[model samples]
Target: MRRALTWVVMVAVGIFAAVGLWSAAVDPAPVSAEETAREVSQSLRCPTCAGESIADSSAMLSDAMRQTVDQQVRQGRSADEIRAWFAERYGDQVLLAPPRSGYGWVLWVAPLALVGAAAVVVLLVGGTSTRRRWWAALLVLAVTSLAGVWLLVPQTTPDPQRLKQEDPPQVNAVAVLRDAVDHAPGNAGLRIAFAGALEEVGQDAEAVEAYAAATRLRPLDSDVRYRHAFALVRSDDPGAAREVLEESLHVRQDHAPSLLLLGALVHGEDPDRASALLQQFVQLAPEHPAVDQVTAFLAGQLDEVPAEALP
Candidate 1:
């Protein structure tokens, strides 16, 4: 019994050591959509809120980025692919970790090369007798092989409790927000947040309804109404969007977005009115970047309202 207990303890220690080595080489594998989204978000820097990953940020842009990550994860996008997507859109600074390819690869290779050289020197210097050298070399080879296998091979725990701990129950952020909205049916902020999250994932129709509810709750908020119109346009309800934009302009005519979107919405049906709204938008917001686009629109182009035209 004593010998068996010793053997069991030795095996357990070896298993844990192997796990430590493997974990040092790579991150824990994400086993569910929520985990995958979290892992991806944690690896990317939040553009609006630096120093915090999107996973930890409460910034609006971070929320959108997280939703995008979740959608892509559900679509089976690989982590590298999702990282590349963010890099392409937001530039390389968005990645918390630099790419392992290209010139940066030297950074990764150098440490490993140094460690290998150190191992070689230790083996040569530590071995004095031929018999000792043989044993040392054998031990080194065994250790290196074991490490290589541990790093390369995928591991799954057979214990149910460990598996439960490793992969907690997946939670859907959207579903959670939806439940919050259901519980607080009059909470316009929850409605708007849930709507924005839906819009981030391309659920335009549902976002339109959510934004519409927000608009009704906060009719005086020009920004809320603008979002409602924008969501309406995305859902192919341009007629209703035009009416909402018109209503927003009636309340706040200085609203550049309402003028800009209404101009485009009416360009085909009412050219003269479209030109007037476009011309007014340029005069009211001359320093705005969209002014140049509006100028082109006045000249002959019908500019599509870019997303988030208000702010």
Candidate 2:
């Protein structure tokens, strides 16, 4: 029995040492841009499709989303930051990963709890004849538990100084726009510029307000109305966007952007009208960057396009 236990100890120590050496010798391979884009896209729902990841969808909107992920990855943004950016534009439903707050903790904790309970049961119910084997199993379990704890624990605390160094303060673009609008209260161009800047910064609600002001100031301006409608769509008010786009169409019947945006906004609820609008957009803007996407939508071939064909 002494000889058997000594052999077991030697084997266990040898295994641990081998594992350590292997880990120390191995370096993780760097992920490629396409690989990073795919990984990030897998975590995001396609903005224009139901029940599909952006990585899996071929719609133009999904293609745009994947490109956004690729750009963010290339810029060295964390996965969490990319997810947050999408959530800001598309809402929390866009994320496949559950939020860390609330019931999300349950999913993270349950697996470790089960492993620990299994370890305890093995310790309590094993027979004496298998004592050595059980001891070895327990030793393995202890190592696994330590590893799990290390992985699950938060690795770093937020340092205010480090954060300041990493992200130097950016000028408040919206605030500057607001000041410009104040100085030129009656300038419709100033209001439209302010709205565009707000939209770029993910202030969709404020952007809608600024766009509305510009639209009211220049009700006959097809471009201003089209921009206002686009802002409304971004702000999650698609119905209002449709109304504004219809009015813009009344002002300029061949406005391609308004037709395209309106078609996208109403596709789910009014496919026939959406198709007509998309067809009109294609006819009016045959050389536009989005023409291929609109043509695919009209032909019902968007779902058949491969993701690689997008960008």
Candidate 3:
């Protein structure tokens, strides 16, 4: 039993040591749709926003654009192919995603070169026994070979149309917005759709125009006004955003997202107002994640305030 326990402990320690070393040596590669979208969005302008990208946008159109990207990725198109297709359609403005050819070749080769250089330095300094050195080289070579095979192997072809069909946009918001604008030639609905898509993709300024158009067309629509206010806030025009939100609330009280966003906006500049609004939000939505986060954040701020400001 003693001998067995000793061996078990030794094995555990070895595993822990190996894992620590492996983790220390390997930098994780980014590989999620969100990460890819962020990377791509940074490079491309939002079609609707003056200078926003789809990755940062909150409008419905931006969501559609991202959905399109997700569909292409699913259909076995390389990231490069997908970006290139957009570039062709919208010109260089569409290529929010990184290029992989020519100057972009550095993105592909730099990581490998860095790893190789580090490994060589480690080997030279570590001074492993001959047998260990040979084994390490062989293992590294095997890993490299496997990676090459994976990258070079032909992928299974998929039908692009079918992939898109599988994931239809929630609102067809992108097309409907475009068509409305084209057909009506100053239609507020169409403008709203266009602006919304731009905002969703991170073009705050463009979204504001659409929201403004929508407000002009339907002065009674508090939702449009609320959206406009948020767009202004997102664009760092807080004074205008507050005015819009106030107008929206006057038209229709008890708006949820607007209220929450208002609370968030006021939190830093006017803690008293922020605290009151956030407290209301917390009471209204105790179970919501946003509520929880806001409550905790507000509590922290309260804790930081001077004794004189507590009241």
The candidate scoring highest on TM-score is: 1
**Candidate 2: regions farther than 4 A off:** 1-171, 303-311
Predict model 1's lDDT versus the native: 0.70
Q: Number of clashes in model 1?
A: 0
Write model 1 residue lDDT over 1-311, tens digit each, in one string.
44544554565567667767767567677778888788788877655543566787786556656766776777789877998876765566666655556765675466556556655666777656664455445454445544454445443213433333342222344664675476556768878988987988899999999988998898888888889998998889999999899889888989987888888788778988988988888888899877876676567664553444434
Which is the leading candidate under lDDT? 1
Of the candidates numbered 1 and 3, which has the greater TM-score value?
1
TM-score for candidate 2 = 0.43
The global C-alpha lDDT for each of the candidates, from Candidate 1 onward, is 0.70, 0.67, 0.60
Candidate 2 or 1, higher lDDT: 1
Model 3 lDDT, full chain set: 0.60
Candidate 3: tens digits of C-alpha lDDT, residues 1-311: 44544554565555556555554456333377656555544554456554456676675556455656655655666556666766665555444333456665575567666657655665776565664465445445544643453344322223433433343223334453554364454556557768877777787887887788889888778778888887887788988988887777677667655666676666678888878776776777667557646766776844432312211
Clashes of each: 0, 0, 13
Clashing pairs in 1: none
Model 1: lowest-lDDT 10 consecutive positions: 155-164
TM-score of each: 0.46, 0.43, 0.40
